[model samples]
Target: MHSQYKSRQGHTTLGNTKTTVAAPSWISDFKEITKMRLSISVVFSSLVGYLLGVDVIDFKILGLLALGGYFMVGASNGFNQIIEKDLDALMERTKNRPVPSGRMSVNTAFIISSIFTVLGIIILYSINKQTAMFGAISIFLYTCAYTPLKTKTPLAVFVGAIPGAIPFMLGWVAATDDFGIEPGTLFALQFFWQFPHFWAIGWFLYEDYKKAGFFMLPTGKQDKGTAVQTIMYTIWTILISIIPVFGFTGTLQLSIVAAILVFAVGIWMLYYAIRLFKLMSVKAARQLMIVSVSYITLVQIIYVVDKFIR
Candidate 1:
């Protein structure tokens, strides 16, 4: 489902000497390896972190984080591809990745990943040591631990959430130069959200992932246990999203109205998760995916609005 390939237009006529005018395979290969959508989503979180953290919005620092975070995330993904090349080949969705498709050499991919990782860390270091450290830790955990553990256990999603949530926290640290309630709050927000988001994807692509030997769900099979757990996490996500309303999480305070709005969105998302638990159908998973996406975007927007309003 991930690596989608479409056939070219009409076949050449017999005796036609026209060669297909296509770009270099390497160009396509890079795109496949980078996974543009995923890299963009990762960088979006980094940008959100930067926006939330900076008291005085500095476009220059924001630019640096965006570019640097992209490379950092891309590097992690590239290395992940290399590690999972074998398994990826087994999955229809992943079989066309750069390494798996033979469009890029493994050495080439590794070199590119190394360059990006080093450059990303250096750029983050310019912002602050904490930012750089978090970036480094994210890449390390994602690549060294989470990537390899995918096939072994579903708990890997839990482990993966640690690195996954770092971008938002990284933003706060970049601005404050220290980790505190603000960064902790942002971290918690993203941390809990990942569970439902990923589980939805896992549910939708359960068959595809299983083909690749990935145990992405807690129950391995898409069952009530897994769906109920997904619903529980979504409930937790909703609870954490509105916690700032209680006026206890330092400067990040959400008003009653904002909390209610956020809670409504959470409940909306949880509806699908609960449905998935009860019906255990792909339709429920699809609905949850839509709701999960809406949940994250709305939650972040609410956070930004609450910060200015409250």
Candidate 2:
């Protein structure tokens, strides 16, 4: 506290007061509730897929897809937080989230989630019936199936992967309003990539996740078996990534050089996965997580550039 008093010669004096300014609590609360960075990154994947699928890109549709994607992902995360408020408070990583930290009421979070879900579907439906259908399904599966199962089974990763992988192919669906081998290949790429990506995260955050009773790893531990499956999925990711170079993905075809570049990054990621398996350390797991993120982005970039050039 501070007080001001009149000084001699009618001068005003102030004592022991300073001000600290921060973003409004509501602003920070919104960002945390939506997991804004993650939602944007998810939208980026969808945009990449849209670019690959479109012959002539429509900027309007692209914008709508981004908005809709963000809303849907945000809604899912919000609902997850609402359901796991207590669980999130139990884990170091998630304890500061809005619902868990008491920065926002659960009812408020639920309303935000429900609104986003509806608006996301309506925006997506403006694009195409198929796109909206997928968005709705993604929201339903993620909140209904994935969130509740997180603490119940190690297979939650498998369940979570379905909605996680949808964003990429959802863009293709947004572009063409069709479902076929093209979007399927894109879906497969993301689907396999998540196993290694998330398993590495699971390994590194094992203790924290255990505090919340989250069985993220396939075998529910950071062991050789989980590492081995990480390897298997990483291999599958690489195979699916390179398949376009063989001229089998229809409109999703890639140049041999792009495929080679993709393969190089995949092997780079695999090297880290092997290190995680051998070292069995959080350090190695963290490195694998970083590489897996880079691998997906690099490969997606390679595919998009290859598509435009060819």
Candidate 3:
């Protein structure tokens, strides 16, 4: 009888230990539903934009911008997962996410996302009206237009790029308190960069995305058509990067040396795109993705440095 009691007690202890270990893992699972890494990247872009926008740095505004940008980007990402949770369950890459994996309730996710949406907008309002409006617009477009369109058509990439480009341009407005040629220039640069960046992502994730019913590429199949179009857009991206060299785009001018350097990076990226177009293999697609990342980061650095040095 004592042996039986001891066995039962041991079982109960193990059960409790299991429960305790599961709890924190569950909370972490919930956080992963928001695509935290992607939001971090978005916040980084916003921070860089904010830094480049202002002549003098104000840590206070930077704090507000970071806080507000995180929530805004987080909310956008959370709602994106909520809307796509069902679809995510079908994709290998996304099937383990909190919502799709049943670690977090969809309703709970929605409520948290909604809360962040409002909080983010209010915080941005504290910075400037233009910033607030831009933040709100980004949320709306990402959730409303980009989220749904992903399953419906390939044009979703184009639609999503608008909001994606806004963060960099947003800083110019946040600092200058107005929309002018400078912001427009910033907008143009980021806008053109998105095509190559996102297309490379789409290309690399094409198989996983197809499982989720997302036709991300213009070709709608992992084929030469898509690769060709990606190369075309990359060429356009390179062209736009050098535009400010002419000094015709208002105060957003780039020096010949800066343009040459920026143009070299662009060509390097385009070379990868060209390789993808020729090879049409996953290896080439992966290289294009790497080059695309390098391209954007380098271009932004060049723009900010040129602004200061020249």
lDDT of 1: 0.84
Clashes of each: 2, 0, 0
Tens digit of lDDT per residue, candidate 1, span 152-201?
99999999999999988887787778888878988998898899888888
Candidate number achieving the greatest lDDT relative to the actual structure: 2
TM-score for each predicted model, relative to the true structure? 0.91, 0.93, 0.89
Clashing pairs in 3: none
Which scores better on TM-score, 1 or 3? Answer: 1
Worst 10 residues of 1 by lDDT: 1-10
lDDT of 3 at 128: 96
Q: After best superposition, candidate 1 residue 153: deviation in angstroms?
A: 0.9
Query: How far is 165's C-alpha from truth in model 2 (Å)?
Result: 0.5
Q: How do the candidates rank by TM-score, highest first?
A: 2, 1, 3
Residue 281 Cα positional deviation in candidate 2, in Å, after optimal superposition: 0.2
Q: Give the poorly placed runs of model 1, Cα more than 4 Å off.
A: 1-27
What is the descending lDDT order?
2, 1, 3
Model 1 Cα shift for residue 96 (angstroms):
1.2
Which residue pairs collide, candidate 1? 1-93, 3-93
